[model samples]
Target: MTETDIPALLALRDNPPFEKMHTVAISGMGPVGMVAALRLAQLGHDVIVFEALGGLSAEARASTFHPSSLELLEQLGVVEELHAVGLKAPIYQYRERSGAVLSQMDMTLLEGETAYPYRLQSEQNNLTEIILGKLQDMPNVTLRFNSPVARVERGDRHVRIHLEGGHRDEPILAQWMIACDGAASPTRKSLGIAFEGTTYDDRFLVISTTHEFREDLGEDLAYVSYIYDPTEWGVLLRTPNHWRALFPVTDAETDEEVMSAENMEARMQRLNPKDTPYEIVHRNVYAVNMRSASTYASGQVLLAGDAAHCNNPLGGMGMNSGIHDAWAAVECINAVLTEGVDATHAATLYSELRRDAAINHVQARAQKNYDNMRQDDDAARAEQADQLSAMDRDLFEKREHQRNSAMFTSLRLTLGRLKRELHAVKAPAVSGGQKFSKLLGQGPVYAAGAYDAVSAKLVEQAGFKAVYVPGSAVSASVMGQPDLGYIGLAEMAEAVRRITAATDLPVIVDGDTGYGGVLQAAEAVRRLEQVGAAGIQFEDQLAPKRCGHLAGKALVETEEMVAKVKIAVAERTSAVIIARTDAKGVEGFEGALARAAAYAEAGADLVFAEGVYSLEELTALRDAVRTVVGGRPLMVNLSEAGDSSALPPLELAHEAGVGFLIHPVSAVLAAAEGIAATYQRLLTTGASGKGQEDWKQFTTLLRQDEQLERASRLAAGEA
Candidate 1:
C-alpha cells in the first residue's frame, strides 16, 4: 500500500465488512455509552445512543485516566485530543496529613508497558465533550439527548427499548441493546439482575478550589496524593483548572457540619496553613458503593459502565472499568452478529470476565486503598506504611502496585487471562479433547498445583504446561480441612471448573478414591469431564482416603480398583485417565507394581506410582510400568512431604522415563509459608521483616508491554 492510499487501506482492514449489519440501541449517553456507540459505528453497525439528561453535566466525578483507559480512548481515536487539554501526572504519592511523603509511586515505571504511561488529570466533562463531538460526526451514530429509556423489553429476534418522554412515542427496536445508565440503572432493575454488594456507611465530600496549595507549601508534590491520617484521612487530586479534596464523613458528622464553608476552608488551610482563607469553588457529597450486576448481558440486552458495576472511587477504576466493559461488550456483540459466533456464549463470557475484573481488581484494590489511608490502629498503620515503603523502594513491586492503583492493568490482565477461556468456549467442542491429547504427548510436562483461579493464572503466566489440582492442596486451601477424602467429587469438579475457566492450560484433578465405588467413579469422570477437566487421576484407596504420605491409608481390592479405572476410562470421551495406586505403603513395592500393571491393562492412559521411596524405586517403577504398557506415559508425584523415592530434579525425572512430574502442593505451600511469615513479622515488629527492596518480581513480569505497544501503533494508524 502506498503512503497516499495507506489511510484508506488501513481503515478498510480495521473495519471489516460485516456479513449482516446490526442496529444497536444504547441507553445512557455517558462516556461509557458514547464510547460504545462510537465503537459500534466504527465496526459498521447502526448505533443510537440515548441520554436521560438534556446535555452533558459538568459534574465533579472521576478525573484521573490511567494508562489503560488512555489506550482505550486512543483506540477510539480521541486520546490525542484528550491529552492536549488534559494534564499529565507522571507520579502520585501516598502521604501523611502533615505533608510528609510516606511513599511515592512513579507512573513512569510503566514506561515500556503502555503507550500513555502517565495518569491524565482532566475533568470528566472534557472527555464527554470530546466523545460527544466524535459521535455527532459519525453518520452511522444517532445521539438522542433527553431521551430516557423507560423499560427494556427483549424479544425473540430483537430488543425493544421504551422511551419515557421522548418527542417520538414509537419504541426503539434494535438487534442489540446496551445499558450505560448510572448505578441505579432502570434497565438493570427491570431485568431483575441483583446489583449486589456493599455500600460504605461514610459519605465522601469532594471540594474544588482554584488556589494553588503546592505553591503555598513551597514543595513539589505529586498531582495526586492520598493522605493518611487517623483523624482525617482524605485524597487530594489535581485537575486542569482546580484541585479537588475528598474526605470521608462518618455517621457522627452531619452533612451541614461537613459541607459548611467554614469546614471546607479549615480542611484546606490545615493542609498548607494558607496566608489567607482557602477558596472553595464548589463541593458535593456522595456515598461510595461496591456493587455489580449479576450479569452484564441478558438475552439481547447488555449492560456497560456503571449500569453493570460500580465501586469506590479511591483508585479511579469505576469509569475506567466501565469503559473496558463497553469495549468488551462491542467486541462480543460484533463477533456474534457479524462473525457467526454464538451470542449467548459470547455474552456469557463478557459477563463472566468483566464482572470478575470489577469485583476482584477494581473493588478489592479500592477497598485496600481506602483501608490503607484510614487505618487507625497503630500497628496496622505501621504495617501499611512499611508495605508502601517497600513498594516505593522496589521498582518491580512499585510498577505492579501502580498498575492496579491506576487501573492500568485491569482490562489487559483480565482479557489476557481469559483468552484461552474465550477460545475454549467459542471453538469447536472437540478441540478440548484434541488439545488435551496433544498436551500429553508434549510431556514430561511440569504441572503446578493450584487451588483457586488466581493461582491458576499465575501458574499459566509462570509458563507451566498444565495445572494439577491436588486433593490435599484443595482440601487444605479451600476448606481448611485435611486431605482425608472430605472433599467429594462435586466439590473437586467445581474447583476444576473454575481453574479451567480461568486458564487454557490442561488441568489434571485428583479424584480421590473416585469419590466412592465403581459406579461413583463413572459419575465422577462424567462430572469432571463436563466441567472441562483435561485429565483426572483416580487413586486406589478406600472411602475417606488420607494423603498418600499420611498414615491410616487403606486400599480397595486390586480387582475392585481395576474396575474403577475401567469405569473412568470408559466414561471419559477425551479426558486422560491416570490410575494412581497407594499400594506402596500397604502392599509393598512389588504389589504396587502389580496394581499399576492391572490399571494399565484396564485402559488407563497413564499410571501414577504413588509413594515411591527413592530415586531408584521411582526409576524401577517407571521401567516396570513401561514393560506392562509399552510406550505409555508414567506420572511421578514429587511431593516435598510425600514418599517420593527422591525429590530428583525435573531433568532427572525425564531421564528416568517419567512423563508427568507433578508438584502436588508446592505452589500453595510456598504461598502459605510466605503469607504466614509476612503476617507473623507484621504481628511482632509492626513491619515486614524483609528489606523494603526485597520483593517478589512476579507482578512486574505480568506487565503487558507488548500489547500496549501494539495498541499504540494501531491508534497512531501505523499498520
Candidate 2:
C-alpha cells in the first residue's frame, strides 16, 4: 500500500466484513460466570459452564446488590426473579457506636437515575441460581458440574481446557474462555498474569443469625447499617431469612477464636444487647484482599469477576462490578462474532475497559469505604460525621445514593469520579490512530484540549476532529499545581486513557521530556500505545519542564532530541509520533526549524516547533518538516489567547496549509472559570442549583441514549 493510502487501508482493516458464532467455555459458576454464560447463551452462542463445586452454596455472600447492578440485571431480564427472593432496602445508614445516625441516604432520590434504586438484600447465590435455571432451559447452554478446570491451553484463535474431573481424557475446546473463577483462578494462574494487590491484615468474621437487627437497633435504623467505633467497625446486613453481621478479626485473633460460639455471641450482643444470647445460625471467617489481575483478557481467555479482581465488601462493588465485567466480556466477544470487529481489537478493548473498572472503581472505592469506616483519629472522624450530617438532604441523597449503589461504574465512571463526564467503555470499531489518520486526511484540522474525560466529552459534543490531552492540563487540573513537571508518564497516560474512553475522537497526548531520557521515552511510547493514544508529541524541554508557551524554556541537543524521536518511532505500535522542539524560544527560530527537520528525517511521523513566536515561523517549520513526512500535516500548540499575542488564529493557520492544531489549555481555563463562579454562587446565595434540563444534556454526552437502546434491545430479546 502507498503512504497516502494508509487512512483508507486502516479504515478498511478496522471494519472487516464477516460474522460467525463459536462455542464459549466459562469456568466457575459464581454470579460472574453464570451471568456471562446466560448472556452469551441468550445471544445464541454455544456455551459450556464448568463448576468446581457440585452445586450452588447458600452461604451469605454479597447480600447487597446496587441500583446500577439492578439496572444491568434488568437488561438481562433477571431483576424480577432476583427481587422475588430479596428484600429492598431504600435507606441505609452510617451510625456511631452509640446508635446516633451520622448520615442516611435514601435511595428514593435516585429513582429517576435507575429503574430499581434500592439495594437488594439478597445473597449472590440467588442471582447465580436464577441464571443457572435459565441457562438450563436454554438450548444453547451446557452445564458441567463437579468439573474443575485444571488449566487452559491457548490456541491462535481458540482455547482448549483440560478438566480435572473424569473428563481428563476429554479436553474441551472452544472459541472463547471466560474465567470467572475465584481469585485463585486456575485459568489466571495458567495464563501467568500477575494479580497484584494487598491482602488486608484483618480477616473478616461474619455471623448469620435469626435475630432481627432493625427491631433491636431501633425502628429508625435501616436494613443496612454500618456502625463505627474505634475498637471495632461492624456491618449489619439483612438477608432474606436472617440478619448477618460482619466484623474485622485482627492478626491477634484466630479463625477458631473469631468463629467460636462465645466470641460470635458477644459480637452480636455488642451490636444489639439482649437478655438471652443471640441466636447465631452460622459463622465463618475469610481473608479479604484488594487485588486485580494485570490484564483481564489474554488471547482467547478472558477473566471476569473474582478471577479478574477482588475487594473489601463494604461497598458491595465486588459482585456488581463483576457482573459488569461479565457483560463486557460477552459484549466484546459478540462484537467479534457478529459485529465484524477485529478479534484482537475486541479483546484488547475489553481488557482496557474492564481492567480500568477493576482498578479505579471496584478496588479503589472498597478501600476508601474501609478507611472511612475505620478512621483512627477521633476529631477527624467526628468532623467527617459532622460533614455528612450537615450535608443537604438532596445533595447527600444524590451523592451517597450513587456512591453506595456502585453507580459510579467504570464504563461510564467520569461523572461518578470527576462529577464531570464519565468514561463509557463501549468498544469502538476503529483504533484511535485509524480514526485520527482518517481525520488527518481532511487537512489542517485542530484538536480541542481536554484535561479529563469531562472536557473530552465537551470537545466531542462540540464536534472537534480530535482531542489533545496536555500534560500541563493534568498538572493543573489533577494536582492543582502549575505545569512544572510535577506529574509523570503514568499520570499523563491515565488522563489520556480516560479521555479516550469517553469518546471515539482521536487523542494526541503530550509526553513531557518523554518523562525522562531515551529509555523512559520508549516506555512512554509503549504505555501510550497500550492506552490507545492516537498521537504522541515528545518535547525537547529539560526536566521540571515548563509549558511550551511559558518563558524560561530550555531544549536538549539536536542529536538528543533526534534520538528520542528515533526510539519513539521504533517503539510505537500504531500511534503517530510527532517530534516537538522547544528550540524556537530557547535557541533561534531557524535552529528550531532545523531540529524539527532533523527529527522528521530521523523517522518521526510528524514534527512540531513549540513556542513559535509568529505565524511566519509556524509556516516555515511546516514547510521544512513536510519534506520528510511525505506530505503529512504540521502540528501547532495554541494556548489560551491571554498566553501570547504572537499566536495565529485558526483561519490563518488553515489558510497557511497547517493541519493538526492543538488548543492545549482552553478546556482547563473554561473549567477553572466555571468552577470559580459556581463556588462563588454557592457562597453568596447559600444554594447552587443545576437545572434538570442541564443534567439531561450532560447525560447525553455519556451516551445514555445508546446505553438505554442497547438495554432495551437486550431486554426485548434482540442482540
User: C-alpha displacement of 71 in model 1, angstroms?
Assistant: 1.0
Report how far off residue 548 is in candidate 1 (Å): 83
The residue pairs found clashing in candidate 2 are 414-422, 414-423, 415-422, 444-659
- State the number of backbone clashes in model 1: 3
Tell me the lDDT of model 1 at 347. 75
Note each model's CA RMSD in angstroms.
26.8, 23.5
Among these predictions, the greatest lDDT belongs to 1
- Predicted candidate 2 versus true structure: per-residue lDDT over 173-260, tens digit per residue: 6778999888899999998999999999999998888987666777787889887877688888788989888898898998788878
Per-model TM values vs. the true structure: 0.56, 0.55
lDDT of 1 by residue, 36-130 (tens): 98889988888888888899877779798888888888889989999888999998888998888898877888888887778999877788899
